[model samples]
Target chain A: MELTIKQKKKIRRAAIFTALLLFVLVWLLPVFGALLTSFRTMDDLMNNGFWRMPEKITFKNFGTAWSEGRLNRYLLNSFIITIPSLIGTLALSSMVGFALAKYKFKGNMALYLMFVAGMLIPFQILLIPVFKLSNELGIYNSYWGLIMIHLVFQMGFCSFFLRNYMITIPDELSEAARIDGASEFRIFYQIYLPLSKPALAALGTLEFTWIFNDYIWALVLLRDDKLKPVTAGLATLKGNFITSWSVLVAGAILATLPTIFVFIFLQKYFIKGLTMGSGK
Target chain B: MKRKFVPWMFLLLPLILYTIWVIAPTIYTFYLSFTEWDGLTSPQFIGLENYKYLFDDPTFYKSLINNLKWLIIFLAFPVVVGLFLAMLLSQDIKWARGFKASIYSPMILAPVVIGLIWSWIYQPQGGLLNNTLTYIGLKSLTRGWLSNPETALYAVIGAAVWRHTGYVMLLFLAGLTSISPTVIEASKIDGASAWQRFRFIILPLLKPTTVIVIVITMIQSLRAFDFVSMMTRGGPFNSTNVLAFYMYSEAFRNYNMGYGAAIAVILFLIMFVFIALYLRQIRKGELE
Candidate 1:
């Protein structure tokens, strides 16, 4: 039977909307269920189904999680590790990116490809050597160790990303600044850096989330409890509370909050940063 | 010509750090793979011995096979399913932004949190999955998900898939946006059915996205460590051990640094092969 264009349009729209809604539910069910479980009491968890509404909500889990889990200390450690790593990665990447993007030099493509290859090399492959080197340098189990490694590992991709972005800005802007008696460094700081704020914001959010979510590096480099980030702290909590469902759930929720909060609040920049490296 | 040394100066800090932390370690790993050193002992060149032992080791073979399985099965979760969702949501739909945000939220959480949450859901008797099955009178279908040797690897992969599908979807969504809307409208005006439109127009347009998804997923699968370490620790008799976790256990836990370095070299070779292939493909695509 021949269908009118209006009927076909309506049908297509309905089918697409229904499928999207179903997909959304499938994607959200696990996250929502986990969030609910975080609020559930051990009694409620054991006696009732995960889908069932709780009899009463409890703030004690969050309280216990914050104190006993030592999440406060872990939060500080995470900030110390992530904030410096973010700043260091951004600053270094931008400086390197500016040079690579703007300057005509020998082996420029080779240098860029080296960074690209570095991005593809797995952290597992680097584990033993990096660990040994860290120990040899007397920086093992220290905050400096974590920060330095994060900066080194992240430098390649960060520089590659920023370089690609920096190339897109009109050369005339930097050239104009240079013609007005600006030094190369001055052009980078006063002209390029100011115009690159949006890109920096985007990369900053991406780097923050990546550094905050890093676990293996922390697990290997940090052995001291005082220096462990939230990921490692949460993993320790899981090991200690192996059978305590409420505490474990609470810890997971607390551990995830910072990243989730960053993503939700700065979602525009986060998404932009993620796709930025992909466009080229 | 006016500033020949300026760019070189800019390259100084990054180059030094990369040489020390990256290139040097890579070369050192290659050397250590051939020596009998345990981080403290004097190195003795053991030539081919570590490689021979790895080939003969059953656990090593199991880990390799499990890694392959992860690469295969994990690809479907993120790439295929994510593409399907992206295609569905790309059409004009209500609450599309909300749907996208909900789906992508899981990717933002730390792997440790995702691992812990899923571990609870997959708990044997009183957990969310088992409880749901029992409540619906399908108790026989439910079993120890993460603990059972038969299902342990697959169970962890399921959790990983759940966490990553949103990420893949985001990539596809971006790809979808870049596609010219006029092409889709033209197909519709040509009286093409929905399936026809997708099969002929949309799917072909998404080749670049597919390539990106494949490369990223392959790398991610190769780096599969955190979830396995957190969830099962390659337990139930090493049923779920991947190369990453296996290498960690060998190096840190067992102190077999030489053998671990050998394993690390093998993993690096495998990844290097894929990356080489990906770069080649991208180059070919560019040429075309």
Candidate 2:
């Protein structure tokens, strides 16, 4: 039977709509279920299904997670590691990127390629060596070790990102500054730094979330319970609360908030930063 | 003298720091791969023993195969699903932004958080996934999703696909936006069906984005560690172990630094090959 054009179009439209709705439900189910679980009591979770409504909503789980789980300490540790890593990556990568982008030097392209190659190398490849080196240098289990690893790993991508952005900044700006008697350092500080704020902010936000959420590195390098960040901390929480579903949900939700906040606040720049390498 | 000093001065700090921290360690890692040292013992020349061990170890092979599985599955699911969603959402749909955000929110959560959340969902007895299965009257389908060796690795991959499809969708969305509206309009005016428009116009135009997505996904999937560690700890007799997690276990947990270094080198070579191939493809695309 030959179908009319209008009928075919209508069928296609309905099929597409159904597919979209089904995909949306699949995406949202776990998140919504987790949210609902976070608000229920352990008794409620044990007695009722995760999807079921509780007799009353409660904030006790969040309170327990915050205090007993020592999330405040982990949050502080995350910031301590994240901030320096951010500053170090941005500062080193920008300077290196500026030199590569602006000045003609021997092995400039070679160095740039080195960073690009480094980006492709998985962190696992670097893990054992880094851990050994950190231990040998007496920085293992210390915040410094974690920060250094993050800086080194981040340098490759940051330089790659900043170089691409810096290339578009035009050589004329730097040359004009040089003609006006601005030293290179002075120009980097006074001109380039100011102009690169948006890019820096974008990269910084993304990197902060990454470093804060880093688990494998922290697990390998930082052995002391006191030094572990929220990600690794939550893993410990999982171990302790293995049977307590409500507490686990609470811990997971708490761990997710900082990254969510960063995303919500820097939503626009975060998207741009994430897609930076893809476009080029 | 001032001019000469200025260049060197500007280069001093970064070069010195990066060399000490980055370049030196990389070279050292290679050298360490040939030595027998466990972070406490004196370094002794071991030749190729570590590499030989890596080749023979069942765990390493399991990891390598699992890594391959992850790469293939991760590459297919996100791109195919993401492209489909992006195309669908590209239509003049209500609440498209909300839909996009709901999909993308998981990507923003830390992988550890994702791992934890999914582990709960994959719980054998009373977890969300099993409960839903039982709720819908398919009680027999409910099983130990992450505990059983057969489904452990795939279960983690499912979690990853859930987290990443939106990210890949965003990339496709951006690629879709850059496609000229005039081309799409002209195709429509030719009485091209939706399938024809997608096949003849959209797909041809989306090649660059697809390349980017594939390369990124391949790289990420190969390096996947957190999910494996958190969800399975490569457990149920080393079922879900991937190269990254295996490398971690060897070095940190087992104190086999040299062996771990060997695994790392292998992983590096695998990634290098993929990246080199991708760069060549990108160069070819540019020429075209």
Candidate 3:
């Protein structure tokens, strides 16, 4: 069958569309099912199966999860943990990054490499010791305990990212500010920080998602259930609410919403953060 | 001298925190690996006993093998899917932007959420996969996918691939975008077929991106944990257990801190190899 070139092109386009659509389905199927399960009652999900269109949908599951599943408590805890950690990481890293990127000093390169390598080490190596350390410090099972751990671990990646970003800014800007009789802190505050806003926003988005999604560290450091972030709290839900699929699914959806919203609205920054942080 | 002191002032706090929290704990773990310790008491020094036990442990071997399986599958599956999708989506097609958005939406999600979503889909009784199969008249083909030892690791890897393929696609798209359109047009004018153009030119030029993808995927698979933790907890007779999850269970669940630290050291070394390669590549570029 000698098809014309245009006909062959049409066939190729059709095949491409089919493949793309198939992958879309593959990616969305689980999420779509979770959404469906979240809306339907547990009885209906059990009897009618996930394949069936829900005969009725209710917002009651969200309410139940919020109340009974302790999602409200967990969501509140996630915010409490994520915000300060974000501020501390960004603040502390930028200072160190500024020093390393902007100065010629003893051990600057060594210090920077140490921070970078700290990020790549399998953190599981430090788990037992950090756990014991946190306990000895009397902050174990408390918010500050986890916050300190987050600060230290995240300082590595943040400093690496920010130092790389800060390096690209011209040294002339800082010099010019210095010529104006600005203090070193003034130059940083006015020149470097202002110029680095885009990178800051990008790193902020990336760091927020990371600190929000942290599970293992939170599980290891924080012992009390009330102090648990949504990640660990949702995990506890998984154990107890084994049969309560609707409420459980609702809790998962709730836990995922903040990051999902960040991704949807701040998507450009998120992508920029990812590619930039990868050292491209 | 004052100016140099100024830099140190800026560096002091970060360095202090990093040492106390990150470096000290890292050193302590290495020291603790040689000692037997529960949480309550002083660590008792026992030279290489935990490492010796890890050598004899069958579960450790199984977990290592499962991690190897993850590395192989991850390197091949997600990279191919990413390249394939990036090529298809970058073409002049309607709704390509929307298609990419839908495809990449999962990548932003937490692995726990993804695992929970897949759990519902893969649940045995009247779950999505089983029901869909039954609807299409493949009644006998459906089984407990996550419960079966042979298929359990694979089922979880399938979930991971779904979440990560978009990430691969995005990186490849960036690489593809940087490639010159003029060169492609010239190739076409020279009577090169599409396959020939892609094979000879495009793939060859994408070597750097391919290297990055390969190393990242390998490291990630070695560090795979969230799925086993969320979905199966490395169950079905420890079928889906990998090094990361096994390390967690031993340390936290069984309180075998010394043994778990040894496993962590192994995982760290494996990761270090890939990270070293990546860092060297980045550093190599820095010199130029």
Q: Please, what are the lDDT tens digits per residue for candidate 3 over residues A1-280?
A: 8999899888988888887788788678878878888899888877887777787998888898787888899989999999999999999999988888899887887787777778767768778888888888998899988898888889988898999999999999888878889999988888898888998899999899889988888889887888999988888888888777788888889999999999988989988887777655
Pairs of residues at least 3 apart in sequence or in different chains that clash in candidate 3:
none
Give one digit per residue, the lDDT tens place, for model 2 in B45-77. Answer: 899999888788899899889998998898788
Sort by lDDT, best first.
1, 3, 2
RMSD of 1: 1.8
Per-residue lDDT over A1-280 for candidate 2, one digit per residue giving the tens place of the 0 to 100 score: 9999889878877777777778788779988888888888777766776656687899888887888878778878888998898899889888877776667666666677777777777887667667778888999999999999888788887887787677678778888988998878998888877888888888888887888889888998898888989999998888887887777888888888888899999988888888775545
Where does candidate 1 clash, by residue pair? none
**Candidate numbers sorted by DockQ from highest down:** 1, 3, 2
- Model 1: residues with Cα > 4 Å off, grouped in runs: A1-3, B281-288
lDDT digits (tens) for residues A214-261 of candidate 1: 999998998999899999998888877777777788888888888878
DockQ for each model: 0.71, 0.59, 0.67
- As a whole number from 0 to 100, the lDDT of residue B60 in candidate 2 is 89
Give the CAPRI rating of model 2: medium
Give each model a TM-score: 0.96, 0.94, 0.96
Residue B167 displacement in candidate 1 (angstroms): 1.4
Error of 1 at A271 (Å): 0.9
Compute the DockQ of candidate 3.
0.67
lDDT of each: 0.86, 0.83, 0.85
Give the alpha carbon lDDT tens digit for every residue of B23-95 in model 1. 9988888998998877788778999999999999999999999999999997866788888888877867889
DockQ computed for model 2 against the true two-chain complex using alpha carbons: 0.59
Error of 2 at B165 (Å): 1.2
